[model samples]
Target: MTAVEKLLGETARADAQRNVRRLVAAAREAVAEVGVDVTAHEIARRAGVGIGTFYRRLPSREALLQAVVEDTVYEIVELAREALRDPDPWHGFCTFAAEFVQLRAMSCGINEALGTDCALSLDAPLEQLREQIRLLVERCQQSGAMRDDVPWQDVPFVLTSVMTGDRTIGLTAADDQWRRNLRVVLAGLRAQQLHTSE
Candidate 1:
């Protein structure tokens, strides 16, 4: 390629990265204030960029939301993987569950912005994360650490419900409360197996 052509391509790629960063920052702030459903134009305005710039970077609100969701899911998956390295499966399960709940709470607004449509193609990473959680939970159950009665498919749903339910109550008191509640829930899950064995 010509020198001028290569320079133009390089500049275009750099500009695109800058625009995406600006949009992502603005979207995060807006979601914190008004929730994720905020318009892309508003996010563009907040970012001090034109609507054209926003559209050029992200084709649609769904696309933007997908980016946010993917970012959050990646973090959760990393945490889960780290937890899996723990020596005890039971402790790993508890740590994973607690961290998962906290991360979900932080990303609640973005998920809300996606609305019911959130589960569309935008949630593939989260679905994969769930599968990972299911495998981890299964490992705990197989080792007789967790309750066997709890189906693998139900792990994500139960943890999500607990976190989302706490979020709805506007409980931002402390991380201790969340951890305590999780322990209680885990106890119940364990109790189910004890009852079955007896």
Candidate 2:
């Protein structure tokens, strides 16, 4: 191949990479706005790319959703790690839980992608997230900040309860009612008896 041909080939590959990044970013926004059922055309339009380019990069709607899901999960995992580093286990756990639910509520696409069976294999990252959550729960329980009756397995359910999604009856996304619900859940999760220093 001529040097010019090689240079052109490298440039094409670079452009493709950039397009993929743009598509993923745009898909995130589109999913947040339109849920998991967002159309490819809309995502492409948001990305400022042609439909053909979006197809060449993501291949299908599921591919785009998976890309967004992967990005969100990685973000969740990082947040969990940061939470684990906090000095107060109960505060860290509460803050993490609130933030986690809020993040999930922002993207119905993520909930759908996670709950449904897709081609994505995220066992390692998922397991890491689970382990971190377990540690946080255990720490809180040991410190008497959390109720012993509430198992680690129940924590996911507690957090997901606030993710009512667009189906919230008589409540809109702008209501900020989920924050109130989270506060209640956190209060219930805490130990009922007060700890006093004698």
Candidate 3:
């Protein structure tokens, strides 16, 4: 007999695996809707599973939060890669950056996820994304489409402002406000280049 069979019957192991997937999906909804402070009981209820099963799978709130972090990080990294494939460097950069604000209304923002109870640990993938941004920014600068004054590190702050604005300051009310704000920032990035050319 296998270790799982020794610990749990074969049917019980399969059920446990199903419960784990259910808990993960439920936790995503709960956290996205109510932030990371969502209770384990509520998550179990959403999953249509028992509290015991939920704890058996995730064990604690922090565990759920860590799972959410992992899922979201993987998703956004792929989105960034997709953006990087665009022909225009500026378009690619903005597209990836824009996702920060665009997706917040539907899911948890970066600050929220990072600030969650799980001690969110994202080192490798985040570094890759930062390097991706740096490469795109360099390409844009070389194309004469972006200002040399701005640094790649500064892009996150701009995105942070967009995310912050969307959450606290009612940017979603105007519908076009985010686009306008992004346009203004992009314009500023190119303003110096245009003046020099003229």
Candidate 4:
């Protein structure tokens, strides 16, 4: 191709990539609220682009869903890494748990997208993240900060409970009730008794 033609081709490719990012963002917002059933045209409208542009970028609704899930999963992974860096494992676990609630609540439709109706199963990455969280719990347990009898699996369950309680209790997103409830749960999670020499 001629130099001028090559330059034009590069510019067009760049524009297409920008359009793809826009569509994916819009799709994530919509799915987080309305679930994966959101229409491509709606996503296009949200992105302030034409349906043709969205189609050219994402190609299909399944593709859009996959993109959103991948983005959210990467974010979760990053948050987990940050949590692990804290010198105090329990404190890090608490912060990470709160962020998990914030992240899920930010995408209000996530419960729906994670439900059976969704086309893509973004479970594997989530499962991997869960493993990291479980390891964090195990580490804390080793320090005697957590009760050994309490299964580590309850960590994610508690995060979900925080979100659910926040929603069902009609607490404002700005409210700190979830943290308080978490504090109460944490109080119960501490090991009750230590062996003493007889």
Candidate 5:
């Protein structure tokens, strides 16, 4: 092939990859709110792309879900990392927890679809998020900002409880309540250390 033809081919390939990334991101946003059952056509419409274009990039619904789930996990992990950067370990932990709750709220349907029992192993990005949270929790415990009595396994339980509670009470009324409850839980965790010192 001529150099000009090869260069044009590479450019076209780059554009195609960019388009696929854009479609996947749009699909992720839509599915988070609506659920994975949403049709490819609906995702395509929301993405401002034709159904054919979506299908060309992702041949099946499962493929699209996998892509969207991966993206969602990556975003959540990034949020965790950002939370860990806070100066105070207690505040950092709270920030992480708050962001996590917000993500679960925004993607309620996706969370429901994944179910509590399902491990995030199938999604690499989400696995990274779990690792990040584990590290942050360890940091908080080591810093004496959090209770050593609370096991790492309990962190997921706490998050799931808050998520389930939010679902039952509804976000409008539960927002401030959850924040207060989080503070209360943190306090209880810290109480363990206080009692030990006393």
Candidate 6:
């Protein structure tokens, strides 16, 4: 191929990659706003790209949703790994739990997608996230920092449940009431008579 042709090909590939990134980012925000059922046209519009460009990159709504979810799960898994590095197991666990809830709060669509059945192949990253939670829980319990009665399996539910604080009450995001709820839940998770500086 001529040098001019090769250069144009490289430029096209670069643009394609940029478009994919923009689409995924826009899809994330769109899902947060309109939910998982958000249309391709809306996502493309939000991404500032044409519908043809979006189709060329993500093909279908399922593919677009999968990209957004996978991106989020990967980020959560990374946070779990970072939590494992903290010296204080209980503190690390609490931090991880709070951070996890905060991350989930970013998108109601994510919470809905997780609760409902879908075709997304999230088994791998999800399992890894589960394993990390197990390790965190075990570490805290073994240190006599967390309640022995609390099983590792309950961690996810407990964290996610704390997120329901806003909905259960009339409080909106401006109220910041979920932080108080999270603090209470974390306190309840701790072993009795153990003191930790907040």
Best candidate (score: lDDT): 6
Distance from true location, Cα of 148 in model 2, Å: 0.9
| lDDT of prediction 4 | 0.70
lDDT of 2: 0.75
C-alpha lDDT score of every prediction, in listed order: 0.68, 0.75, 0.67, 0.70, 0.67, 0.77
Clashing pairs in 2: none
Q: For residues 1-198, write the lDDT of model 5, one tens digit per residue.
A: 422233234435776666566676677777777876677887878778888877776556566666556556666778888878988877787787877776766685457544554422345555677798898888889998777878876886686555435344454555566567666665665636565777
Worst 10 residues of 2 by lDDT: 2-11
Off by over 4 Å in 5: 1-22, 117-123, 164-177, 191-198
The residue-by-residue lDDT of candidate 4 on 1-198, one tens digit each, is 422233234435777767776777787789887777788888899999999876665547776677676557667767887888888877877788778777776675566554345666677767778778888788778877678887888777766666544354564553776667767776677656532311
Question: What are the per-residue Cα lDDT tens digits for candidate 2 across 67-115?
Answer: 5666677778788878888999888998899878888777666665555
lDDT of 1 at 142: 82
- Candidate 1 lDDT at 178 equals 57
lDDT of 6 by residue, 79-192 (tens): 988889999998788888888887667677777766667567778778888999999999999999988999999878887776653453564644655677789889888988
> For residues 1-198, what per-residue lDDT tens digits would candidate 1 score against the true structure?
422233234435777777777777787677656665678888899989999977766667766655655565666777888777888887888888888776556665644632355433545666767777877898788878887888988877677666434344665555556566666788876636555777
Ranking by TM-score: 6, 2, 4, 3, 5, 1
What local lDDT does model 4 show for residue 124?
73
* TM-score of each model, paired residue for residue: 0.72, 0.80, 0.75, 0.79, 0.73, 0.84
Clashing pairs in 3: none
RMSD of each: 6.4, 6.1, 5.7, 6.7, 6.5, 5.8
TM-score of 5: 0.73
On TM-score, the candidate that comes out on top is: 6
Model 6: pairs clashing at backbone N, Cα or C within 3 Å: none
